[model samples]
Target: MLYAVVDIETTGGHASANGITEVAINIHNENQVVESYTTLINPRQFIPAYITALTGIDNDMVAEAPYFEDVALQIYQLLNEKVFVAHNVNFDYSFLKHHLAAAGYDLNCRKLCTVRLSRKLIPGKASYSLGKLCSALNISIQNRHRAGGDADATSILFNMLLETDHEGVIAEMLKKSSKEQVLPPHLDRASILRLPNQPGVYYFKDNKGKIVYVGKAKNLKKRVISHFTGNKPNKQRQDFLRTIYNVDYVVCGTELMALILEANEIKRLWPENNRAMKRYEHKYDLYVFEDQNGYLRLAIDKHKTNNKSLQSFNSLLEGYNFLNQLIEKYQLCAKLCYLQKTATKCTAHDNGQCFGVCSGIETVAVYNKRLNNALAELQRLQPSFALVDDGREAEELSCLVVENGTFYGMGYFKDKTYLADGLAPIKNDLSIYQSNSYILNLILNHAAEFPQKLYKL
Candidate 1:
């Protein structure tokens, strides 16, 4: 395969924001350079003084030069279907892809990094900078920071790597390029391509068909592609990719539905990568219980599944802190709520914050009435409502159902009759998910952020 050794000077570090000022590409056949192209293009934006000082290519110099738009098509044609070779390949490749995308050319090419190759083939180098590496190898560079000089030096270094490569590392790297799907050995590209470009949840299955990971995305195809193409320098990611042998997905009509499905699936499947959810240990809970006199009392107790807590907290401190605020705001007896222990009237009653229910000075009927109101307010934390938002299409809307302060499910409804008449069809199409602390937090935050979209049904 032919290699296009490339180097480009940019206005800034970010590919999406920066403009290309100069570029050089040297075509090689794993032996010697056959053809070379270098040009200074007008970026059409003011170049920073530091960049000008570094590259020696000021705006005045490029004023008469051709703009990137003039040469974009030609450069794209040259690099098409060729292996992209560069020192830090991502920088050059990303810049080209961004600029070419703006120019309406979808440029996709396999990449070969000289720096990664050097690390494997020529290890133990003190510094891997292009200038330092070239200097150590006695390769002469005419212009230190110019695109042409850097590209030529890189091409020579690449040829040396090709000649010394005995273990087929270079071949393996080219095969793992991001231009195409980087799937596991047992998985096929056709499976990934079949994923829809819509809001959905996707599953990564191992070789034995056991789900290893579950994730949600605004676009299933893009998110799945990002997982395989990411340059994660960790063993966990490598292990995950290696074990993924099959792909599965469920399409959601909206982003909100995707999130709910993701949380539910992670909790249900208990996927290997989703251990964080499994490790969630509920330590404390805000509980409501009845005393011997039929008086309703609230306490922050140690959480238990059988207790069926009204609200759960990850820590005792959090539960107590929240209880303290409720005692102060609702003028409730701290002794009754377990915030203060007392034989007679509580300290809140002496402070005129409580109605003296602990000492029977106030009738249970009057005191219980206020306590029930406070409990009802706290119960409203998770509202019983249906949030209707924009769906994947103009004719539909996504409905998120929370029945009696519990997450029922989510679904898409196309007929307007559901909003005006009945919800039988919408209820039948709902995708149910487990109601846990994580899911509760998500629903609460979204409802608060977009209250106008919520319909309290």
Candidate 2:
């Protein structure tokens, strides 16, 4: 029940080199185009020899023809409330949009393409260009490539392709091609439909005005739509899309730029679905909890705000258990470290295994000295350092670092607008963990030409 099977003759090849010369629409319903129209307009310039030879409409033929504005109304009436079916919908639709934009009339319509549908429905066609498609599909064109004739062919081919089955292919391609993926109802299609597939950060927000999820991708729109298609998904991604009333995006020039932008925005908005920031891993684990009895109890608590601990573990039990095994191996004290504080003779001493203070078996001074030796086994996460990385450029990535905070990381800046002089200015970021890790590792690897220089912030 669609209206227009449309085609247009353009001035030339590249859209930037052209203007629409002839317009035609064949209106059809129930698989029949009941009405048809066509017009040639003065393109306000000389028609090239190739175009003249192709369409058989020359410069002299349209030298005195009506201008586009003269016939815009008729074109609108014919195309209004109609599905715009064309060979390559993008070319035709883009040309049409440009024409309408210049003439102060907005042309927005649902678009369907014969090419995509033909690929899906009819299998063996070597080509889908209007000329070849007609020959391949056994449909004949009277004037070949002329505006009205091409449209008539597309209309016939649209019906014939549908005859081959794959019942919903037309509708599905029509829905996807007519607009960008999953747009908010109020926002117009062309707004994001024209977004270049460059690297960028994208944001999704809810009706009550809170950011639900933030992400970055080398292909912005493609990545954003993955949440909707449920291809490879998570529950958080699903829930966010369900509640997303709007989408907002920024186009970064490169992947490195996208990386920084994503980190910055996630920290700023603190989206509910972002899980990387809140999770923190342990740095140091093996430590002594000095009890009030002047006895050292080897526990697995990470060193506090003061001194660094030996290592990190998932739980205190694992730490003490590991230390206990080491204790038995070293034949050390159960009582001197207060492990059996009430024993008259230490558990280890009773078994002739104690090197402990129980029963005056060992001195605290020597025990404390050996305890420092076990502390050497742990690796400590650095407190304050600038983790330099690649910045976004032809031979670059970027740098991110934390100064005096747990959550802060830095951004990139340039001394000059040209950015050809030296290194950019440093901007620290806060509350970004995944990006910090990504910067600390992934982005830095991209800058392999130079070694990373760790500096105290």
Across 1-457, the per-residue lDDT of candidate 1 in tens digits comes to: 7889999998877666678899999999878999999999999899999999999989998999898889999899889999988886766777788788789998888877787678668888776779998888888888979999999999889888998899997887677543232444345556777998999899999868999999999999889888867344244664576577789999888777888888778877899997776676567888888898877899998868677777788788989998888888888888989888777789877779988888888777787888888888887765677788877687888888777677878877786457654445456788776676666667778889999877766
lDDT of each: 0.81, 0.62
Error of 1 at 265 (Å): 0.5
Which 10-residue window in model 2 sums to the lowest lDDT?
A: 415-424
Lowest lDDT 10-mer window, candidate 1? 177-186
* Candidate 2 local lDDT, 374-410, one digit each (tens): 4433222334444454444445433445433232444
Root-mean-square deviation of every model: 13.1, 20.8
Candidate 1 ranges with C-alpha deviation above 4 Å: 2-178, 280-283, 292-294, 313-318, 328-330, 342-344, 360-370, 377-382, 392-394, 421-429
Best by TM-score: 1
